[model samples]
Target: MSSGSALIPLDRALARLLDGLGPVAAETAALPDAAGLVAAETLHAPRALPVRPLALRRGIAVASADLVGATPHAPALLPSAPPVVLGGDVLPEGADAVLPADAAATSGPFHEIGQSAYPGEGAVLPGTDLTDGAVIVAAGAPITAEAVLALQLAGIAELTVRRPRIALMGDAAGAEAAWLKARLARAGCAVTDAAPADLVLHLARDPAAVVAGPGLALQPGGDAALLVDGTSRTLVLAPRADALVAALFALVFPVVAVLQGRRLATVARALTRNMASQVGLADLALLRHTPEGWEPLGVGRVTLMAILAADAVAILGPESEGAAAGAPIAAIPLQEPFDPR
Candidate 1:
């Protein structure tokens, strides 16, 4: 592929790369394997939660009318047939309320109710937790742990989600591939070698040697080129492993948004220090934590060891000139020990 060395704005480059890419197709997956995947369609509760009224405490299920006139001193005796119920148990067929065990006295077969009972007291009614046909998760939403549990509790055995397939074709021996694989795995993408991948990334020594495709090319000198030729897309970056990895933070979310049908903007954690932008180009600077605060490492000094030593990265927008000390900027944390203060 012919390569042109033009310094395109980061935002414009990302928009071009993500313009036509979208969730591949819907597929079924079990609840446990659904975490981090994007929902392909809105998931609705098939049935109301707690089909029957559920007891909320350890008590005797009794009709509320039976304890209407009951008092502490002059207690009302409950019928011997009232079933003993524990917390989270379904209320018995004939019971409309629960009389707490501690609030009643038992003698032989009869249980005395010392307090008044109210209908629906100490019980969760049908659909209280989730209503039938209500949306459990909206389309394009990420499936989180909480969402998984909710789906399981709602009796959903399987869900349809979009698992984007990404292929890594270069720099196998470098940290960039490893880091990208790990990051995509954490984001619930399936990295595979299957033909016609949703996205392909190539690392090259010479910008002119990049694979022929419709994609964006990023170089170490802050130059970017966008090539569009139908569905064939690729991203070419300079083989400086550490700086390439740092610059990737600005691109990952946009890629995810395209593959998951999400409307998310490229965002990073808030920066812990001020950052200076290049005169005409956006800047992606690696940051390390020190006893004083967070500081930006020199762009030329970003090596694999230096990247491993850093805890975050600060991204200066194209519009801004520089950030004052303590000014909040967007940052991408590379490891733990990231403190915003």
Candidate 2:
């Protein structure tokens, strides 16, 4: 209310936030700690996943050629079978197969191979688990649980990834600020207190103060602003407790996309009722996904009740006039992915 700057479009505001910003420098992280981050570049296996043949069962390793023609009727007697290897153990140098406990019998200090064995019987041949030259993780892929599993299986302990570091500039102890911190982390940001962070989120609610930043055109959050200095971008969020969340998706989330090179997930849902929006300003619609479709809770400065009742949000861009009943819209999901509802 104090700044006389003209209100800027939401997209323009986001673009200003990204004016000179780029993905932060890549850092090496242990595989276990890399989850929820984006890979800096495509990664290939450093070596074969399992460098040697692997025993798939608890049994004696054997040279398959030596067991040909051997059977219960005419067992091939041997001084000893190849060295014993358990599940997950590497087959010994002289062994090409794993003879199950039932396949071998001991007779007068001699190990008898009673069943024939093939070269790869009961064993995973070398490079079969994951080839030596296969791609371990593609560029820009999220370091998810599955991706981490494959990396670990490939004997990789670390990865190079891009994790934007953000500095919180406002009421870090306030409930709204804490919520913002958590959501930012889920978007693959490292929230911290000091300098060197790639971005800063300044939370303020001082109505008497005149600040210099972008003229935010978002309803319920138009008072917020964006401050740019050198390579540092600070997002000033004047979040009334009820407007905290709506303001974030409206102003802050898009910057994450610019840095990480990926978009946050959204689910398509049909609106349950008509939702009208101003043609000139961006609108934030809080919603509850019901059995039939999305039930609009409230738009603009929604109530605490509206926030609690909501499970997702739909942002009507600056160019839009909102949607009619049964109109499908892309919404940012606020609940866990496994919600039964």
Candidate 3:
């Protein structure tokens, strides 16, 4: 449905929302509190652990050359050897490998060498434990449990992470605003009800009324829009029964993804029925799984009751008119379609 000439294409609106939008301010969070937060800076390994090769078994350290050609049939006698134990010793001076205990024997002052010491045999080499300057976490990547453990082993006590602040203002308690708020929170945004926010979500009961002061192509009685509030980016939602969800996904979600420096991911599925859309406007579709394939529950204006039964959602770009039945379309999952026990 055409709102008016004032309505910008979803892609252009997203570009305007993302133009020069860097990450929000960075804060130092202790390692324990870092998981689920976005890394503001890349962290590198502080040092190489076990700087030298360490023994992998109970053994004697010796120059590999000293054991060359030595075998049980032709034993090479050494004056003495430095003792190395598993988890307790490094390769001794002048030693390049570990000769396992069974490979050598004590004979008075000479240590009998009965096996050739293959290079790197019976021992782990330097950096086998950790390498210096290796990337632990890249900037814009989420801090995960595995990442946290790596950082701990790398001696990182804390990390620099970015948490975008969002001001979620709803005209009243409604399912649409609640859904949007929960989605944003799950995306790692810190939600508030005050100023000083990196983003503002202004939800209005009137599908096309301005609760937040007007500017930036938005009409007092028009469609939902993205506008600026000083340095804060504001998203005004005209919560029309049919239009609310389309705005939430196409405009709001992408804006938040940019704030966190990420791209929205989608899964591909074959459509069960042909979909139709306005060529110049992005269309939102809600879908459900059926025996044949994925089927659209509703397109464009969808009832909340219809939305509840959906398994996935897809936002068709403005460049697309629609797709024929059985064609693959990218969709975003609201929940797992097939539960794996």
Candidate 4:
């Protein structure tokens, strides 16, 4: 039987994509917390992790050799020793390890004269827990709290990661108004609204704005993607920005019929499939202010319609369009644009 759409289950789709693409990383969040996030590269141990054995409990320090001579009947008297606190490093010279206060009779000195003590029987061995330059975690591994702790223990300073970024355009567009820029910045992304943006966001209050943004965004060939989301609607499409308006008119609808004074269907079948591995959309801004009035103009028409639809769209606009709406887009050729908003 033929299905209406070749739809793979969401879980199945994710699994396939993950398997093919491998682990994707976000920017390096601080260690001791950003566990589960993919490591940018291999991180080496700063010095030696757990450089020394931490005492498990409060106790007295004693040398394994010192206890060699003790016996049950004629027990050697142990010399008076200071109390060792938990986490204290046991010195290797005289004390092989520490004896828990509860386990030893500290009231009297322990003295052994004739017997021998076993090696490593009473103390922590150096480099047993972990050694220096050990690969604590690998690249593409998910960061977890435990991993964060391990990184901290390993003494990692700065971590390299794929930082999230968003480019903005729309009816009410402004470089400062880019929510993703602000959000990512707050979340520790060195953000920029420049072209070749990691992502693009078509943030307008209406569908019309979305259309305009897509028209503008789909210019740099069909390689970069577009995402439009707001008010229970999200459209992932790719439109050829480089394609002339006349070419689109020829492809989607018959301009000749319209010229002949026939009002054809307003909706055109001009959609480009999403070639993105990951697509995310969010209405972080629940706007309610009704626009007084706006006449559709140039690319702004899409933004205006969105205002009428009471919905918004975010598109991964062209990398060049970083200036305020009216201003010119940048000159750089945008690549790998992102729209994680």
Q: What is the alpha-carbon lDDT of model 4 when measured against the actual structure?
A: 0.36
Off by over 4 Å in 3: 1-9, 12-16, 46-50, 56-65, 76-84, 87-101, 128-133, 156-159, 168-188, 192-194, 202-228, 236-249, 261-275, 278-281, 285-314, 325-341
Report clashes for each candidate as comma-separated counts.
0, 0, 1, 37
Name the runs in model 2 displaced over 4 angstroms.
Answer: 1-6, 64-71, 74-76, 108-110, 116-121, 145-149, 152-158, 207-215, 239-241, 266-269, 286-298, 301-312, 333-341
Q: Is candidate 3 or candidate 4 better by lDDT?
A: 3
lDDT of 4 by residue, 123-199 (tens): 55566656777776555333446656767766675575543333334432443344333433433234454534433
lDDT of candidate 1 over 1-341, digit per residue (tens):
22322456667777877777777788899978898777888888899997888898888787787888889888888657468899899998757677767776777888777788888898877778788898878887778788888899988988998777776666645766677677776665787644367776555655445644322322233432245457766666555665466445666556765677765432234345666655445556777766555677644235666677777765556566666666554555664211211
lDDT, residue 63, model 3: 76
Best by lDDT: 2
Summed over model 1, clashes come to: 0
Q: Estimate each model's TM-score.
A: 0.74, 0.79, 0.63, 0.42
Best-to-worst lDDT order: 2, 3, 1, 4
lDDT of 2 by residue, 1-341 (tens): 32223687777777778787766778899978998777887878777767788899999898888889998989888887457789989888867899877777779989887789998898988877787778877766667788899889887889888888888876567877887788888767888976667778777785215366455777778777776778877777764665567667766666776676656557888999998877777888888989989999887667778877888877888677789999998888775321111
